[model samples]
Target: MPRQACKKGSHACDGVVRRNAEPIAYAHGFDWRPAYNCKQWFAEHSEQMTSDRGGMMKRYARPLRLLAITALSVFLGETLVMLLLPFLEPLPQHVKVLLDASLVTALVLPMLYYFLFRPMALYIGERDRTQKSLSKLSSAVEQTADAVVITGMDGVIEYVNPAFESYTGYTQVEALGQTPRILKSGKHNSQFYEALWKTILAGGVFRGELINKKKNGELFHAEHTITPLKDDSGSITHFVSVWKDITERRRAEEALQTFSQRVMDAQEAERRHIARELHDEMGQALTALSISLQTAEETAESPAAAEQLHQCLGFVERLLQQVRSLSLDLRPSMLDDLGLASALRWYVDSQGQRAGFIPQMELDSLKTRLPPELETAFFRIAQEAVTNVVRHAHARQVRVQLHRREQEMEMVISDDGCGFDAQGLQTRNARETSAGLLGMRERVLLLGGQIAIDSAPGRGTEIRVRVPVE
Candidate 1:
């Protein structure tokens, strides 16, 4: 038999032959080449050919194995047909039989390989690639610094990554099958949770800061982003929550806020002291001078001069009253002695008399005194609110209500006046004119309170303030 030629020149032939030289064995009859030379050539090139063939087999093993099995099955079926040919009386001759078998192998085998075996192999490879990609994604999420938690549709935790365990002190085993409520610190009430669930179930993302309890019962703060994951049918299947531990950030922010509040309080105290000096010291000296002028006029012989001194004394008394009012506005002694309710009523009545508006005061279930700080905060807010109404509201009637609810104090002030735009009143220019409202809000916030203003164009405004009583 004639052997195939190697495509490239052999290494042994490289120096002896020029480039593009043909193999020495080409066109040689079966017996023409010397047996010894043939054996030597075979020995030299066999290893290289064997190595190349082995690499090709390894690279195409899966598809080739499948093709071989399919081909063998077809060959066997054709052989069975040939064996049964003798039983048929009109069977074709050997030449026709050989041609038919050749045609079946050539046509049927390649079709089966292309349509069935190749597609199956490609699908298997693709599935493996998909699995590898999913594994990489899972590993990346697990190693992230942010806490990753996946919960079932029912809000029960199904999976939590290593970062979540590290930040929350809850191991995977402990957190599995647990609800997020396990981390609740109880700082917020049921209403808060209701709102959170409402927003999330409506297919909206929820973002907020929460105080959560860890596995060891230590509380920590976290900024959380929760998103609902949906299936192909657009139904929510799970919730993915990404959170970062923000305990230190929250602590630093709170420290800064406390420092700022302390500075404001100190400044207010100094202002109160100065106002007292002006009203008591300077005001008294003016009164004495006015009295002496009246005495001197009475001792004089002229009646006209005595009348003028009396008018001067009246003006002096009015000046003293104005100074006293300024001092009281700076720091009211009534807030410390009479409590928040009485102080608020006094402020409303005094502001009404000054601004010429009819003031309506209502107090419910606040007969007892409160903490000094609370009393002062409430009094200041009331003072600021009434002042704003008088200066800006342009109203004829004002109503102030103070009510003590369970664990909270609620105050509302409403006026029948031409109210300005609340949103527009938040800018720099509006703040200058509405400094009283801003001051009231700051004071309420310092006392752990919230204020809400309801107003629109051409409508009366209402302000509601709520503070924690405990």
Candidate 2:
């Protein structure tokens, strides 16, 4: 019969036990005798050695095997050659011995290199390099600012880095093995997700802006890219997603847009004030001068003097006309007194004079006036759209339509001219675009409305704008 041995004390750790004067309750499995070793040094540290021996063995196992195989091959080759040397033609014993040794060396060296040493060297070297790179990658993922998510092929969350936990209001314990759909914000439609899944399943990377919710249900915007991970068989194994929160950046951009709109509005108001000054003060003065010159011409006794007074009065009339034209250019009085519709009609007429093509006009339900700020925004947008048509659209005809409803107002202007690219307008620097497309967009957007432009090169251009009446 075989017997098991143990110490009558606690198993302080693996491969280690402590002894005391009295037997303890823990040492019950196989102890029937007194244990022998009781060195304090070994008792304190033997557990660490036992754990490390397994790891070190695995590390050196392949190289040790290679060394053993090479040694055996050399021994077998030398022994076979030495036996064959005895049968060969007679020679001096020392020389024959040397010859056999040299032959064995020559045969065994290449065999060792080709069969074991070179292959092990190449494989171990590559594995070590790969492991180091993987270690670096793991560290970077853990410390980076961008949120990183690793999920199973079926979209089950597997791992999330620190940044992910910080922004998502989730801890590692709460997120594992859950579906990523738990974070859906519902802002993106089903089609959006369908497209995203389709791209990833097809082995393509998906990159886009997303609106995602956190654990506490706060929605935020993120710019993210999701890439598929594949196994050696080229089948999708998992997904890696990296994202950054862009909520603050987007808010700042929106604030900047608002500030720009305010500046534009103030500038327009100042122009209106200047226009009123020109019309009321300068026009009246010029009219009075013309009247005085006419009276002088009537009282003149000499013909030459009367002729000169007549010429002077004509100059005064021209000057008055110039001042009136300039006043209207700055701001039309009809816009203030009547409303948006009246002002638009007058503008169409005035532009017709300059461009030699009066746009075909249509107006509907224009009886009630809108709020002052809304009216101003609508007018400015229409003005810019029409001006672009006259300056850039070389077409001989234009169409302008304004519709007023209970809840909203919409304007559509179309021209049959050489149209420019809408994308080109968007890409150009804000100040460099000649059409004022960006300014027009800002105006309508500030009013919580949408503006759309349909244009194509060598074709025609159409601009549409809608704003809420309130």
Q: Pick the candidate with the highest lDDT.
A: 2
TM-score of each: 0.64, 0.64
Give Cα distance to truth, residue 253, candidate 2, Å: 2.3
- Which residue pairs show collisions in model 2? none
Spell out the clash pairs found in candidate 1.
none
The residue-by-residue lDDT of candidate 2 on 130-243, one tens digit each, is 999999999999999999999875577889999999999989888887766767887877568767877887899999999989999999899989999986447677889999
Q: Write the per-residue lDDT of candidate 1 for residues 279-337, one digit (tens) a residue.
A: 78977888788789778777867888888887888888888788888878887777766
Query: What are the clash counts of all predictions, listed in order?
Result: 0, 0
Every candidate's lDDT: 0.77, 0.80
